[model samples]
Target: MSVGKLPVIDLTPMRAGDEFHKRALGDALREACVHTGFFYVAGHGVPQALIDRVFAASKAFFDQPMADKRKVDKALSAANRGYEFLGGQTLEPGAPPDLKEGFYIGEELAEDDPRVLAGAFNMGPNQWPAGVPDFAPVMMEYYGALLELSREIMAALALSLELPEDYFEAFCTEPLATLRLLHYPPQPAQPLPGEKGCGAHTDFGGVTILLLDDKPGLQVWDALNERWLDAQPIPGTFVVNLGDMIARWTNDRYRSTLHRVINTSGAERYSVPFFYSGAPQHEVRCLPGCLGEGEQPKYAPVTVEGHLREMYRRTYV
Candidate 1:
């Protein structure tokens, strides 16, 4: 069954064990994944109060003086945790730098942790901004909530792919996830050519769960029509999209479509995107049922860490 221009899926059924409902959930997810790689998920159990606190903390932190914000700049940590200045990244090669500032948060590990000692890529203690009192607590709480929700979504994805519900259990263990808070200023009247709040690019991880403010700016590419479709924000729901790893795992059976943002709402826009990249050591190979008879895997196997490192190199180097 088609779910309109962009599907709005209910996760409430996925939380229960009724076979019929589970299968129906899987079917809906499969439709979204195979077609647009985007959907809106409702009935996710995160509290609205906690979501509000997160947004409030984000704005409070961003409103701080530049000197205070720069104290925890991402450059201070090799693990890529902390604040990122506006235009710090260019997601689309050859396009102007992205016109947004962001902050990154990840699992809190101590300096002497084994992972940190081993110099693991993007693995280390998070640097918290000092001035925003509620920033640390609210963000950590929201991160925990999103992390658990992502595992449930991953299970649904496995079911959609005709695999067992726990097919990604190993992959979810000790996953490498990132919670990013972004602020996009209004689009300039005469912006630079190809400039945007974020550039046209596919995400690099397994999945992304994005929370948006009431302003519309997100857009997903409609490859079939060769046009971009606005992804309007809907209250009480989060926009979900697949990433490159899913496409690779399915041998391209599922899309990891290109998307971007442009803050044309004439006001600042704030969003939170949780990137659920599975275990750093998990081996990402083509799934068993993804290939046709006598067809070989299109890409060689790579560990999650290896894939992430390569993607980071391409974008940040």
Candidate 2:
């Protein structure tokens, strides 16, 4: 039923535009979401050539001189779009900072865009590193592809919950998604206690679409089993995981599992994660189906932007 602990779902059936098969795909998605909150997506329609190009660009950008990378440091951008040096983020409280350097890209907006004019959180143009001249275009192309795929996955999620297929249409419009390229060096021979490539934390958004390099490091917390399970990288598949907002939306009927990376492969590792957080103004509330007859909502209503700001405050503070 599953590749390992996580399900391997093929989107090809749904891509055929068959209503019957689409609902069948939704059923499988519901199982994976409720059980593991993680899965591998195959036949997602992104060209392998494009995927390869994006990886090449990521490595090239990260391979640039540290001074060059710092020229586009995330601190320099108001919207938090740029390079983040290793150990810059502490995802798990009390643990050592994550040992990964990353670059963030989001919807390319102009200085005069209304969202930018209003000074919305994380709204503005991206700051690209000029050292890797082709990085921006390659990353943007991959971003565009993932955006389309994210919406399709959202629609399928709606069907999974027995909602109208367009239930999340508004949320997908003008989304506050982010595409992050991360590079993790091999783990230290004598690592600090609790140190990891990425600290254990649940994602903050709607859904995350991740492309991983062949080196192993990813681990998903198995709450029921009370152990960490390796999420091995599979060729031709992207790892997909639900985020905290989805758990909030579903009243926790679906999980937002904790996951981290611990690159022990003795080689460099690179991964690209696209966070599909939905629209800034979209209000997230418990779905009717997610609650029992007398169950109360576990969380209060919050807009996407508000939730993200709160999550960022907790992790970055």
lDDT of each: 0.93, 0.92
State residue 210's C-alpha deviation in candidate 1, in Å.
0.4
After superposition on all CA atoms, what RMSD does each candidate show versus the true structure?
2.1, 1.8
> Against the hidden true structure, what lDDT does model 1 obtain?
0.93
lDDT of 2 by residue, 170-241 (tens): 999999999999999999999999999999999999999999999989999988868888999999999999
lDDT of 2 at 228: 88
lDDT of 1 by residue, 1-317 (tens): 11136799899887865989989999999999999999999989999999999999999988999999999999999999999999999998999999999999999999999999999878899998878887888899999999999999999999898899999999999999999999999999999999999999999999999999999899999888788889999999999999999999899999999999989899999999999999999999999789999999998999999999998887777
Stretches of candidate 1 off by over 4 Å are: 1-4
The lowest-lDDT stretch of 10 consecutive residues in candidate 1 is 1-10
